[model samples]
Target: MGWAEKRTGIAFAIALFAALAAPDAYAANGAYAVDAADISEVGSCKVESWMSVATNTDFSAVANPSCVVNPFTPIELSLNTNRARSDGEWSTTLSPKAKTNFVPTGIGRWGFSAYAGGSFDAATGENLSAFAVIPATYRLSETMRINLNGGWLWDRTVDRHYLTYGIGFDWKFTDTLQWTIEAFGQAGASDTPSVVQPRFQTGVRYRPNEIFSVDVIYGRNITGENANWITLGTTIRFPVEGAQPEHRRTGHL
Candidate 1:
């Protein structure tokens, strides 16, 4: 091509590049822009520990918590413990068990968890009781959930399994407070006559940040023989991380 045509082509290319790179002086900045910090991943795999105290139980207090695991995935590990107030009195339970929770398929993310544990009656330094529970939950909303739990207890001294089933409701009153109620007992199918026990629990959870949380729970065995319990606990998660399971929409310019 001729020098005049070549120069014209080069000038046009340079003009196009400059027009695209330059911004209008009179135009304002984007009104809705997502910052990298806001779009970054939130939440993490965390391990938590707890301490509970009771006024009516043989053991006045206990410290127990589970190992590190994600709540969305199935959890398999021992969760807590039961202790005796004094050594020579009743028995210190050294019960350990495995547990797993399965996600619900059809009903807005329902889940079921199963636990199996053996009890040791410290009086004789021998295992005396076996226990298991299958608990299911349905999320009623972002702030509320209902759980149905069935449990079985077998005492070595009696050689019979006690079956129990109950329901629990959790209400998140705020970002830092929650309330719960539950009722459980043998359903009269066991060899011996069954009795029902209803319980109520209330708690406040303090989450100062994404990686740390603490909760205080107060409970009462409402029916049958009445008893009260209080629990104070804190949990810390390492290298905090979390992600929302729900789908989202995005707009791009």
Candidate 2:
């Protein structure tokens, strides 16, 4: 090819990769244990779904669809449904969650966010759990970051109050390939202790474009049970057709 044609191709490639790295909702798309301190742009929405296979008693599937809106504050709202099947028995849970970033996430800086949510039994509407979490992030560079979390959880089933924590690291090898590893756990009022102990997870996220991602993860002791799990998850992100609200922050680590 001539020099001009070659130069044009290189320019296009650079532009495409830059768009993929743009600060958007996909930055926090595929985390299993620690949530990111970022949110989708206002008027943007996404749907995340995953299935995990482990022992018969620990197999589960989940669907969570969420959207960001700027009513008074820029917040992301989601409704998640989970179905667990084990030994021909099935149980369902419904959870609603809300999150908003307090400090914007950027390269070589720190960010913070807040999350609140509750879950109930789908069959009986019985309260199962409620939680409030503070998530923080520090971007070591444009392609690497660290996430930290601390929270409080109310285990309605056992009437126990627990403290939760998480630490995670992200490394982006390229515009389309990324890896993350995290450790998370909970501890209750020591006397009774938390039902679920510490857990570890690692995942690789693949983004073919700016609006889609696929993740495969391996988790250890996922649910306080000594079960190893393998999960496949995906996320689809897009902008709302007519709703337009000013975005609070733009760009990500």
Q: TM-score: which candidate is best? A: 2
C-alpha lDDT of candidate 2 relative to the true structure? 0.62
Sliding window of 10 residues with minimal summed lDDT for model 1: 25-34
TM-score of each: 0.59, 0.81
lDDT of 1 by residue, 24-117 (tens): 0000001000000001111222334444444654233322333323344333333233444532354344444444433331235655445556
**Pairs of residues clashing in candidate 2:** none
Q: Give lDDT: candidate 1, residue 184.
A: 42
Highest lDDT: which candidate? Answer: 2
List model 2 lDDT by residue over 128-204, tens digit each. Answer: 87777777778787778888877787777777777777788888887678898988777755442223567778999
Error of 1 at 108 (Å): 3.3
* Candidate 2 Cα outliers beyond 4 Å, as residue runs: 1-31, 86-89, 189-194, 240-253
